[model samples]
Target: MKLKLIFLLTASILAFTGCNNFETLNTDPARSSETQPEFLLGNAEKRASDLLYDTYFNGRIGMELSQYWMGTDKTSDGRFLFTNDGLWSGMYAGPLMDLQEIQNYYDRHPEETNPNILAVSEILKSWIFHILTDVYVDIPYTQALKGDVIPQPVFDKGKDVYSALLVSLKKQIDVLSNPGTMAIRGDVVANGSAAQWVRIANALRMRIAMRMADAQPAEAKAIIEDAVKNTMVSVAQDAFFPYNVATVTNRFPYNDVDRPLVEFAVTSTLVTYLQSVNDPRLPIFARPDETNGKYIGKVYGTEANAPTMIGLSKPGVMAYSGSAKGYMITYAEVAFLKAEAAARGMAVGSASAEELYKEAVTASMTQWGVTDAKVVATYLEGVPYKGGTWKNVIGTQKWLALYMQGIQSWMERLRLDPKKPNGEVLFIPPASGSLDPEVTDVPKRLKYPSSSRAANAINSEQAAKSIGGDTQATKNWWDTL
Candidate 1:
């Protein structure tokens, strides 16, 4: 009892020293520590570390499975070791959960509202909602983050979520504009300031608004225009996270598994595109095979064909980077969005979609370390978007720009699929031998996490009744395009 008292006394001294600094200290929802503004900002940092992980899985995990990319695929489930659920809870539980909790804390302590927390939440929330929409189309949004106070939150129409995000992004951008917003105070990101936060928030708004192209083209145009009128002009303001081996959660484990259980490699389809374009990014994007010394690509489900040597997996095919970075919105993505919006007749700075396509391609190459001016010049030889349909113009430009970025790439294709979901896929990834690739197309949506169904059984039952079956194939609003 004396030791406990001593510990309490020490804490009180420190708390008292810091107490005067606080405008108003409040009781945190679950924390016994009297959280002042600094603590709340520190909490934002802790959450940012967690939020960084969201990019790898929700943003990028399922995306690899959807399209034919240069490297990695287990989502097919043919031979790729990862099961559907393995793909399900990849990173959502960690980061998404923490973000919700932080919001709850903020809600309880309104005085703690500062530029960093407000802006970070607004920007990251758009990302969270974007990932959820990509997977399920519609989800609980109008009533989200309510915790036990609201046990059963109805799913918002996907369109509604997009609208809500648009408002949040705009509001938060203004909050982060003040120089003193995070200055002379605690900070989450080391080099982050209020201006940087606004840039990211605005850029993300541009991306989100463009996502509504098909479902609400006119609305998409208005939002895009608002963004271009007030948008980011460089990659420095990019809202991205740096990843390293020690920061494993911030990186995608698909390409960095610890043991030798799952075996998948680069996709042949992507290899062909890289080679055909003679794109310099191929080297940076994919690692060469150590055995054959050839750039070998693997079929999604059939990663282990060493014995057969037909689209087989090799040990050193993929060049793993322990310190690789995760991408959020960047200049490359913005260019591509512009290209896409232009294709759909969304005017911005009077640049045509075709013009934007060329610019986007060049910008993307530059962002991926494609520096040599001559090499860049040569890579731009191909005619930009010779095809007329938005699918060919916007879709193809986006495909190249979104390499390894995640669900953003897959959604582009989903957006352009035939109105009735019947069309010829130009880049049909090498199919999972398990599924008769000719017959069954890749799924467009993921089933809900089994745990959610098991624990929230009552809610799950209602969801099933409302949405026909919570299967992996249910198309979300954007995917249903």
Candidate 2:
């Protein structure tokens, strides 16, 4: 009798739960979940989407600090690197915190198993792991985020983190492909649809695998092939978050800010690459330097007289415009990776590497609103063509797409064409902060945040001891390639 009563009450409330605020407070205690599993699932989906936007704050901002633009002034004591303490706070504190919680909750309950949340969380995990492994290089992971249960987390080597992420992603994608699907009540791309989320998950697998190129070429090639079969082969299938004017929640971060006053200016290396290739995407990606037509970027060490920009005084509104959701992965990036793999005779899809290379180049230009047939024709015509200049073709495209994003463009400068090294370098130098140049062919890795040394002294010391050579000069495990 009691069970019957509980079941009846639960069904009644689930019917009306949507009419009320999404909070489960109104739900009948005994039968709420059974009565309306979809409602709880819907609310969870909403929370997951919220997680994606927060990354734009942490990750996107770092990219901006990289070389896309110069800062208005020093962001951190390590101004040379535009070393924002916020990067850790934002990446670890925000996106990571929620992800760790959500994943654990998902693991225990295993209820929200649809592709959207699965893909979303899986992709989010990949990025979070990427950020930590790439920047901090051997920070906590193996025992990290065990939550209150296990407080002192052990720092796993970066290669371990990458391997673990790949395995986890591969498993989840397989389960998602033909398993009991979750109830997706909200607008969740990764979870809401199986095909799309699978695509994203596969793309992420390829990405992380590519990072392992130097350390585990065989493993990397296998993973890349696995991903290529199901991943982003064309722009129609890129995993992107598009910002809409109607939705202020999704607007691009730079929409309301004064572009010129923000202190971040376009860098010389970037401008030179853009101008050299005569890429039309330059005008679309950056505002013109009104003072002198030639792109004038300020060096990072400048104490005064910042570079000039046009419409500096112009008032701009945050009306539905230029802002887009942060990019998790793009078709161009995948294509470039394939091109590299092809150059090395790695496993990939049907097209010859050269064919894929041209496709990748055109896809990048198209994304930037460069619709001029002539420009497209010239880019394809290979006028900027220099023989054996694979770096010229692939590196520039990679850099161009990663604008305002952070070290990715600069990273290409380091990695592309590792065989025949080039004298060219790309980086966002330390501004009035570093005593001298990075002294590396490229900016290697960020300095450990000052707070790490002060606040988390004991644990950080252990990390520094374990990771070894934790300096800007220290090469990350993945960067070995």
Candidate 3:
């Protein structure tokens, strides 16, 4: 099933590439062209969701790095044995290309173009690029997606990329805020709701702004303040793709029948922390140990030498099901961002940091379907903000709330401890003897893929030189402590 899905996605890419001159192809009787902006938008949406959810989130590499789960193998991701090839390819060849095609379609038919479709395309483009830049730091931005026009695109500085993305997101919001006929036919995520799109755009801006908190404080403050005033105000406004079991393209990839039953185990770092705080979200996050009928989590990076897995907890069915929704950005995340802003003396709505923090936690609980009032109330009472160490407190809870959305969680961990002497944050523990001796700590950024080296050698070499070196230890502009 997974292979079939991959074939279909690959075929879609071929179809788009084969009809590069879509306008001319549209007039030819023998060639089929995707001239409709709605179709292009739909395809872009699905491709983006698949890359973000299936390739990144569901892949569990980020989860292992973030210490949310532990692998059972010796050379597993818990020991930092992973690569960014899947992510690099998915972002560049799949969604990024499709989004660029949407822009190309808009450029060809300016008068006939739907404003909402163009706006959504811009939002998604920013979304995919944001993920790309966050993970790899420096990436092709200005000259990216130009195909033959600029086959060897130079990598832009991470900060410059963020600046450009912020400008793009703001433009999308301005276009979406006004009253117009939103093209909803191909929008699987928000159903073409202009209001929802605006909310998502603002939320995305907030996320990018927070990513710049350490490196670009003034800009981050301004962008975050504006986002707080305009972004998703409630859980109902969260941007997410609802996966359906019947839709092969939209189904969660981890739900495949051939997948291993014990592919991942709840990490001791996560379960122990939750248990210490008596977090009600634990049972919802992981199944009880089969042997002791209690929650048991394995130590990170020690899965290979760990004792029998008869009692270890695995991720629950809902956590890895085909019907699980893929979140682009959520109100809870926005709330937490606002909380952090408030803690930093930035005005984010009428609520104080404590108020926003509690609200964020509740919103996350609600999103996970944990509606028991007592359970929520108890958890809240147990984990109230202690006033000091705001970064650690908020960062820890945010990490917990961002389960399954692994990449974002890892990014947050980075932001929280941008320049730690040891690359460990609140929820993610320090790397011990699990990693290779040469790897001193958690990686700051991914090396450029081998494909980039072979295909775009000159530009790739320039990028590597500009960003220190093409190694995991090289820190991006935003990694400044």
**Which one is best on TM-score?**
3
True-vs-predicted CA distance for residue 317, candidate 1, Å? 9.6
| lDDT for residue 119 in candidate 3, whole number 0-100 | 82
Which number leads on lDDT? 3
- Record all residue pairs in model 3 with backbone atoms less than 3 Å apart, i.e. clashing: none
Question: Total clashing residue pairs per candidate?
Answer: 5, 17, 0
RMSD of each: 7.5, 8.1, 9.5
lDDT of 1: 0.58
Model 1 lDDT tens row, 1-481? 9999999999999889778856445545466654454444444444444443342443234445544442343333432222445333433444455556656666788776555565665566676677776666656677665656776566676678888888888887676665463552444442556666676676777877766666676787888877876665665655555555675654433445464422335566556666765777677666566556677666444434443333433323222444444566678778777777766666777877767777777777777777677876676665346535646655655676666565666666666642211223445533544343222455566666676577567766676656666665566654445
Native-to-model Cα distance after best TM-score fit, residue 175 in candidate 2, in Å: 1.2
Total clashes, candidate 3?
0
Off by over 4 Å in 1: 1-63, 68-93, 106-110, 178-190, 244-262, 300-319, 387-390, 417-425, 429-439
lDDT of 3: 0.78
> Which regions in candidate 3 have their CA more than 4 angstroms from the true location?
1-32, 55-58, 256-260, 303-309, 418-438
TM-score of each: 0.77, 0.77, 0.88
Candidates 2 and 3 compared by lDDT, better number: 3
lDDT of each: 0.58, 0.58, 0.78
